[model samples]
Target chain A: MKARFIVSPVLCIGCRTCELACAFAHAIDGKLGKSRIYPIDGGFKELWVPVTCLQCEEAACVKSCLVNALQRNPETGAVELNQEKCVKCMACVAACPFGCSLLDEQHELVVKCDLCGGDPACARFCPTKALEYKPIKGSPKKIAV
Target chain B: MIRITINGKVTQASEGETLLKVIRREGIDIPALCHHEAVEPYGACRLCMVEITKEEWNGWSKYVTSCLYPVEPGLIVKTHSTKVIEMRKTIVDLYLARHPNCAEIQQLADEYGVTKTSYQTVVDGDNCILCGICTRICDEMGFHAISMVGRGHGKVVAPPLDEAPANCTGCLACAQNCPTHFIEFEDKGNSRTIWGKKFEMITCEKCGKTTITKEFADYLAEHRELPREYFNICDECHRRSTALDMGRIASWSKEVK
Candidate 1:
C-alpha cells in the first residue's frame, strides 16, 4: 500500500499553528526561515485555508525546470529541488500549478516541499486534525478540494 | 562509574543508567517522546534511537533506543547520525498518521523536518500519542482511575467502560502530569467534574478559592500528613495575610520606640 497526505477542511480551526511550526522546523539555527505551508485567511467569517505543495503525480514544476534541478524521490514520492544544480531562473516557480515553489530570499535558492524527506512538519504541528498521513490500499487518489 | 564517549566527548555514567540520561546529563540533544523521569522506561516510542559503536559488541556498530539501553564502559555513542535522524523522522511520521491534532507530536515532526507524510489518515479527531504517561502516573499514585482501552486505531485513554471509575477520587494528578492536557477538568463553585464524574469541592475558610476538591484535601491531610490549618486559606491569601501580620508587628515595635 502507498501512503498519502490528506487535508480536511471541516477540522481546521483557522489557528495558523501549522504555519509557525513549519517555519520554525525549517529554520537555520534559532532564526525562523521560510515556511513551506502558508495559511490564507478568509476574513471575519474565519475561513482559513492552508496551502502547500500538492505533490502532484504529474508535477508541472519537474517539466518546467530548464536545468533539471527538480527531481522526484521514488521512496518518498516528493519533488525535490537540488540547490547546487539550480540556476535560480524561477522557471519552476512559474511552472508550479499550485504556486508552491518560491525563491528563498536569505539563501538565494528556490524552495519547494520535499515532504521533509518523507516526514512533514506541517501535518505534525496542526492543532486540529486538519492534516493527516496514512496508507492507501487501492489506486492513488488526490484530494478533490 | 562507567565511562562512555558521547559525540567525541568522554562522559561518566553510573552503571545501569540509560544512555538518554547520561547524554542529557552532559547537555547533549536527543529527542524522546515516551520517556518520563518518574515512570519506568517502556521504549514504546522509538524517537530516542541512537547509533552506538562498541569494541566487544558483535557487528562493530548498531542502533538502539537510548531510553531502554543501559550505558556500558567503552561505548562510543553518536546521538545524531544520518541514519538515526532518518529513523527518528519515520517514527514521528507514524505518530502524525494517528494523531494529526496533537501539538506535541507535530512539534517533534517539525523539528525533524517532516512537513508531510506519504500515509493516509487512519483516525480522525485523534490527539493522544499513547505515551502512557497519564495511565502510568495514575497507577503510580495508586488511583488506577483510568487505563488505555481498545486496540490499534481504536485505542484511547478512557476509564473502565467509558464511565468514570467509582474509585476515582477526583485528584488532578493525572491532569497535572499529562503532557498534552487531553484530560478535561472543569471546576464549578462547589463541585469539580473530571471525565463526567463530579465531586464536592473544598473551599478555603480565609479566601474563596474553589480549586481544591474535598477528596484531595482529605487525602493530603491524612496520607501526606499536611496540617489541616494550612488549607484554611488559599495560597495567595495565605501569602498576603502573612505579609500583613509581619508588617503590623514591625509597626507595633516602631510605635513602642
Candidate 2:
C-alpha cells in the first residue's frame, strides 16, 4: 500500500485556485462556475495547498475514531471513513497531527481527501502545475492533464 | 499493520501514519507546540522534536519535528533520549523567554520544568514569551495582516506600520485570536484605528543603556528604506557614522602620543 502526498512549495505561487477548485468539486452544485460562495467558516482556504491524503500507514483518524467509522482502504491504501457510522465524535479531528480532516458544515461527518476517487479535481484545476497527482514510488512524474 | 521500532520498542503502526502519530499513539508523549490536529503542521514551533535512527542513512540519526515527519519502513525513532530531551528543554526555554506569560507556553514550560527564561526580555514590560502564535495565526489561520519581522533576538510580530491595506476588511482576527493578548485595538483621538498595541524595544547595541522605540526602528527600516542589516543601529550610532574618516583622524593621534 502506498501512502504519501508530495508538494513543492517553491512551485506554488500562493494563488489558492486549488482551494477554489476543491471547494467547487466538493460543493453541492458540483461546479466551479461562480465567484460568490458563502464563506463557510473552517472550510478550506484559498492558499494553493495542492493537498492530498498522506494515506498514513499509522492513520491517526483511524486510531482516534471511537465509533471505528474510519478505516484504511485496502485497495487504494487510503484511509476511508464510513460516514454512516460516524458519530461526529471529533476524535479523529483531534488525533490527526496534520489537521487534514475537517468537519463538514452539516457537522455529521468528517471530510478528507479521497484522491477524488483516483482522478483528483484539484490537480485538474491547478493552472501553474503546482498540483500533481502521481504514484507513490520512483520520481513524482508529473500528471499530464 | 506495519511493525516498526520506536525508541527501541517494537511497535505496530498503520501504513500511512506520520512519525509523530506513531509515537503519540504508543504513549511516548513527545512534546509538540504549534501542533493542533485541526490545523496543518506549520513546523514553526519546532518543539515536537525527535531523533530518527535511520539505517538507510547508515545508522545516522537526525533531529526533526516529529509532527511533520512521516514514518518509513525500517526507520528507528528515538523520541526521548538524553540528547533529545536537552534539545527540547533548550527550545522550550527559548520559547518561554519569547512568550513568558502565554498559558500554553507556561504549560509547556511547566511540563519541561523550564522555570527560567534564556533570552533577555524586551523592556516594554512585555511578558512576550515569543510563541510565534500571533504571527502564525495571522498568516496561516487569517489571511496575512501581520508577520514576523527580523530574526532571532531581534524578531518581532507586527503589522505593516507604514501602510494599512485598503482591502483590510477590518476582520481584527489577528488581535482577537492572539494567544498572548499582546495585541490590542484602540481608538485614536480623532479616528478609530486598530493598532497592534505596544511592544518594547531592545537597547541599542552601541548606546548600552537608552531604549529606542520599536516603531522607530521599524520606521528607520521601512520609511527611510534602510537595509534590514542596519536596522538595529540606533540614531546615535548612525549619527557617528564616520569610522572611515576617523581612520584619517587616528593617523594624527600617533604624533601626540
Candidate 3:
C-alpha cells in the first residue's frame, strides 16, 4: 500500500525546515519553489501547526477539475496535477473545502501535494518526529497496559 | 452506440455527445474559443464550424458549428475541408476587423493565414470577444454578479446599473476564465478591488497571510454548512488541526534493522 503523511502538531517546533526542504526539492532553475506544505502559527500563537494536502481518497480538486487535469496516481495513491492539460480555470481553488488546493500566482497554475512520487520531502526533512510518512495502515492498533 | 464518420473515419460515439466532442475524441483539432466543460456549450465565437452531412443526403452537405451540433447515427463530419476553412477564414477576418487590438484574434487570424482584414477596421475596438463564458461561469458559481449589457454594438459586460456588484464576493472566476484576458482586477495586500467594488480580505489568523475575501468566506461557510469560526483559521491551520486529530505519531523511525 502507498504511504501517507501523519503529522503531529504537538511535537512541532515550527522551524519551517520542512517547508524549505519541500520547496527546494520541487524547485526548478534555481528559483524558489512553491512549497505545498505550510507550517503556520496556530491561534494560541505559541504552538505552531503545519498544514498541507491530506491526499483524501475523495478529493475536491479532482472533482472540480473541468478538464480532467487532476487525477489519482495509482502508484502513489496521490492526486497529481497535469500541468499541460490545465486551462487555469481556478475552479478547484474555490471548490476545495479545506482550501488545500493552491493557485501559484506567478505561474497561473493550481498546485497541490503529489506525495513527491511516494517520498515526500517535507516528511523526510522534518527534524522533529512530527511529520511521518506512513502507510494508510501504518498505525496498528495496540493494547495499552 | 452511435456511428459517426469523422474525417472519413468511422467512429463510435454516445448518443448525447456533441459532434465536436466526438471529432476531438477521434484526435481531430477544431478551434473553439467558448467551449468549456464546466459550462454548457455556447457557440458564440463561431469558430468550430464543420461540414456535416448524412448518407441519405446524397451529394449535399452543409457547414455547421460543431460545438452546438449534436451527433446522430450515420452522421458524416468533415472537420477540415476547403469550404469549411473558407467559412472559418471569413469569420476570423470579420473578428480581426472588429478586434484589431485583441492579441488572441490576431493569433487566430494568423493561424487561418489571414494577416490582414478586408473589412473596415473599427478604430477603437476593445478586446472583449464577448463569448459569455465569464457570465456563464459566474452564473454556475451561483453569483449572478455580471452579465452582457446594452444592445447590438454597444453590448458589454457590466454589473446592474454599472455600479459595484453586491453579489460579487471578490472571486476572480470571471476574470481568470476570459479567453481574451479582457477582465481586469487588482489585489494589493489584504484588500482586493474588482468591478468597481473593494473587498476586505480575510487574513489567516494563524499565519497572518491574506487568504480570501471575507464576503467569499461567509458565502462559503453558509453554503457548505461549515461553522463561521472555521473560515477564520485558513486552510493551513485547519490542515494542522486535522493532523492533530488523526492521532499520535509513532516511534517506528527509531526501530533498528
Per-residue lDDT for B110-160 in model 3, tens only? 899998999999999898988998888778778899999998999999999
| lDDT over C-alpha atoms for residue A70 of model 1 | 80
Best by DockQ: 3
lDDT of 2 by residue, A11-55 (tens): 455566767777676665454332111111111122223334466
Cα lDDT tens digits, model 3, A28-137, are 67876678887766544345567778776767667655457788898887888876456564445645656677777765667888888899888888988778887665
Model 2: iRMSD? 23.5
DockQ, all models: 0.01, 0.01, 0.17
What ordering of candidates by DockQ runs from best to worst? 3, 2, 1
Segments in model 1 whose C-alpha atoms lie over 4 Å from true places: A1-145, B123-125, B244-257
Candidate 2's C-alpha runs over 4 A off are: A1-145, B1-3, B8-17, B25-28, B37-40, B55-59, B101-103, B118-142, B162-165, B170-181, B185-257
Candidate 3: list runs displaced more than 4 Å. Answer: A1-52, A55-99, A105-107, A112-145, B233-257
Q: Give me the TM-scores of chain B across the candidates.
A: 0.88, 0.55, 0.92
Candidate order by decreasing lDDT: 3, 1, 2
> How large a fraction of the reference contact set does each model reproduce?
0.00, 0.00, 0.12
The Cα error of candidate 1 at residue A101, in Å, is: 53
